[model samples]
Target: MDRVTVSLDELPIRDDLRGQKPYGAPQAPLPVALNVNENTHPVPPEVADDIADAVARALREINRYPDREFLALREGFAQYLGHGLDASQIWAGNGSNEVLQHVLQAFAGPGRSAFGFGPTYSMYPLLTSGVGAEWIGGTRGHAYELSPEDAAEQVERARPDVIFLCAPNNPTGTPLPLDVIEAVYDASHGIVVVDEAYQEFAPRDSPSALTLLGGRPRLAVSRTMSKAFAFAGARVGYLAADPALIDALRLVRLPYHLSALTQAAAGAALQHATTMLRMVDEIVVQRDRMSATLEALGYRPSESWTNFVLFGGVADPAATWRALYDRGVLIRDIGIPGHLRVTAGTEEETTAFLEALAEIGAR
Candidate 1:
């Protein structure tokens, strides 16, 4: 019963994964946690009741495996997305990370390369390397913007086996224009993935990459319920693509990957999509408020189409982060030099962060 401690290097781990770090944010028992870009609002009681009822019904069949195809959940996602999609054109996993991993497994791996714009989703590289694929980081334009020309040029040069385009890109929250997706798709001859985990937070009138899915057999749009639906605890994410691509994913997924309970809970949440999305508007208000307040306080807040904001211009990021941490308000110091990212939380939480930040600036 003696304690045993061994470092990862002592084991037979892969060479590529030798020095790689796992993806994560700081976890702490802070009063206000805006670090991980989660929806801070509680689910509506009525929606929660519906989900609980669905889960209860699913428990009656607990002994049975979930539907391998997850047809009903796919149908719910198709209906929720509503760009003339259907169940056959949909696939899902525990979360969008797993969905993206499935893509890497089927399309990338073993001497192939995956490409993404630099400073994008950190998971793209990790997922690629984990699958034995080389990760090629492409460049973005000024202020983290990716112009159609620049994006297409980069894709054409790398010609990676799989391309991940994080729409309204993560960490920085810079919006990605549909034309850029079009340009990248046209330039690359490989599988194209548009990670739209934050699309719901974008301007309502803006077009989605889903609009470009038709006739594009190699393209996929991935989404998650964790953000706007306040379903992070349930861990549901899905994709919309050609039925052939869906079939490709089926090859790599474990049997009965989506549990009956997960399907039931997500399906019930989709049924109350309207109620769930009402929280998005409030979060958007907080996001905008945070951006404006940051600007007024002399920080350079980036234009965000997601539920979070990445602001720069801090003179001492480490000291400021420590000060905020000490104030019991937690946000992300995502290693962008003077920049830090924060999720849009409830009104009171946002106020607390702003007040803390302002106080730090004053001192």
Candidate 2:
């Protein structure tokens, strides 16, 4: 029998995914890590104890499959969101990333198009393409604000099947106003997803479309325990929407998408959410101080509502990034040509970053 032969050119892979890099892989270690906007503090000892206890209790059930419906977890999550939604209005997955993919799959595949602002979360476009959907890009206003008027016009033109708006957007860290969010929400005839991964860091007045769930069947809010809850490793994320939309997500999600351990850990985290809120308060204070320090150092940092600060107008952002890296600091180089984003860290880490920036500016 002749050996099987296949040419790489004849592969059945989607053409859009060729040469794309995987998301969220960090390379190298740094003395001060401000790259990924992770909670700089570890889970408190008390919280860790609670997690351990929950894990031990859940271990007894490991022999059996996890609750396929995730009803209990979803109830807890909806209550946590301050939304009076039941299990039918919530869905859980391995991570918010998976939940996000489900949204695209359910709404924006094939001839459909998805829309969002540029320089927002980098993953939105990538995820849209992975689902074989066109991702439309819109420009931001002078202050990195999403122009709802422009967005509305575009939506009218493209009539996108899905729209993703990241409140307190990633990398830029700017929050969209309630009016703008509402305008876009009204303009979008298709599903509108509000990614609130960093909402804990935003001000109390920061706009959330979650409250509009009843009126807008097209609106959904994506949340995660990875950031403020310090559970990045737990890999738990959820969505709150109309029961119909939540049901649609269930249809697309794999069975038992969230593990028993993750469910227990996230539930425990939510139970002790006050501790997380205190940590978030401290981080916000540090973030503000760091922003001031960066501005004092002549860096134009964006007004941030999240734990990270984004600064542009660097003569050479690449050099700035390299300088900080050499000083044992890891900040995200957005590679948007001239901008870099720095996540807020502990006080000492912030000081180290400032010192490195000062030294780099001097040279």
Highest-scoring model, TM-score: 1
RMSD of 2: 2.5
Query: Which segments of model 2 are wrong by more than 4 Å?
Result: 1-12
Clashing pairs in 2: none
Pick out the ten consecutive residues of candidate 2 with the lowest summed lDDT: 18-27
- Candidate 1 stretches greater than 4 Å from native: none
Worst 10 contiguous positions by lDDT, candidate 1: 139-148
| 333 Cα displacement, candidate 2 (Å) | 0.9
lDDT of 2 by residue, 87-196 (tens): 78888887788999999989888899998887789889988998999989877877777666876776777688988888878878988766676788888789989899
Query: Residues 39-131, candidate 1, lDDT per residue (tens digit)?
Result: 999999999999999999999999999898888999889999998899999999999999999999999999899999989998999999999
Candidate 2: lDDT over CA atoms?
0.84
Error of 2 at 169 (Å): 1.1
Clashing pairs in 1: none
| TM-scores for all predictions | 0.99, 0.95
